[model samples]
Target: MPVEIKLFMCRTDNFGALLHDRDSGETAIIDAPEEAPIIDAITHSGWTPSMLLITHHHGDHVEANLALKRRYKLRIIGPEAERDKIPGIDDTVEEGSVIPFGEERIEVISTPGHTAGHVCYHLPKAKAAFTADTLFAMGCGRLFERPAPVMFESLKKLAALPADTAIYCGHEYTLSNARFALTVDPDNAALQARAAKVEALRAEGKPTLPTTIGEELATNPFLRWADPAIRKHLGMEKASDVEVFAEIRRRKDNF
Candidate 1:
């Protein structure tokens, strides 16, 4: 009765995923990044998706939407705020919307920073989340729509997830993100260990993802806005959490 999530490469660094329920043999494609790779992944796994869950309207994430929908007759669900931008959306969901994925419940958490309509799909039963570009490994998406304050609040939502929750992102930027993290949290042994691990994984051409909330909490600088040590390191010890978060994001943007 477990859900099996598989990640595959799509359009350079983008990651496309297939979430298959073992109990029902039903599959849901988490973002349609590209058509061919998706098809190849499907062919190999022998699991054709019946639904497509989109987070945003970014072209790289939804470019294969029409193609996949036409091919699989998928029921597409996307953010209500950006329905106009996402093609083939059969249903619109926002924060607090919970939909069924076979026997599993997929909860939507609106994270509108990377884009105004960006969201993350969280499966409570599986303790897994699909954060396309909202929350990445060690880093987050660029603020193309909202400002730092909004993005900081959005990240806090993810930070509140149970520490054991597993996180899957849309890209493999952990190596670079980890490198940037060390510059800010140089004394963080946890981060130092993770960065070394990421380097080794990338060297072997292996994926360095599926970072847990616990691991990220201990290492990701973006999620450490409330830490006093980090505040002191950034010379923002007297600043509010939002201000500190904005400063960290500002540094990352330039890093």
Candidate 2:
């Protein structure tokens, strides 16, 4: 059975996703950003919810977990570290955890920098991954809890996935991320092309997301820590990969 996904806007920039198994009609929501939009998307798709996959306990991500659970019978799953913070959480997952969504398998990847227990879900069969806030189109989440090294390792995990993997992240920050990426990698033709595309998309009020790992690998400065151009631009040519990544992140923070 093929799994179909629908992406929509919720709570300004937050992305609300609906994952449906076409054959079994089993539906799961990646996160409950808002109750109304989620209900609307569900009703529009005519797919009933069976599960709620939470990335973290951030209010913007899990604001409607309990509300949605109240409206439908859902198996709410979240990170074990913040299980108490996620309302209506029925189950918890950690690194290396695997769960089934109809016939497909959902691989839980622990990415703990955005929050101590933040995670991303990978569906290898579908070649799709819900990165949430941990990884973005051309940037990464801020190190709110863990240090730069921890977040860098989390990103490397995602980077280690197949290059063709389609990345569905949590927010619509691609345009800004693209602009920041240009500052560090001005000579990259791929980055230049991607930045122009992102600018055009935002001009048209379109979503600048669903970027692939290959695309991110080629353009995202945060992911391009080893790119000689970036290393030279940052004047950290002799620094470790982790140190170079931290400087890029620090610059982005002030950018």
Best TM-score among the predictions, by candidate number: 2
Query: Which residue window of length 10 is worst by lDDT in model 2?
Result: 207-216
lDDT of 2 by residue, 1-255 (tens): 399999999999999999999978899999999999999999999999999999998899999998999899899999999998999999999999998887899999999998999989999999999999989999999898899999999999999999989999999999899899999999999999989999999999999868899999999888988989899998999999999999999999999
Per-candidate count of clashing residue pairs (backbone under 3 Å): 0, 0
Shift of residue 152 alpha carbon in model 2, Å: 0.8
Candidates' TM-scores?
0.98, 0.99
Candidate 2 CA-lDDT value? 0.93
Best of the candidates, lDDT? 2
Q: What ranges in model 1 sit over 4 Å off?
A: none
Measured with C-alpha atoms, the lDDT of residue 114 in candidate 2 is 88
The deviation in Å at residue 123 for candidate 2 is: 0.3
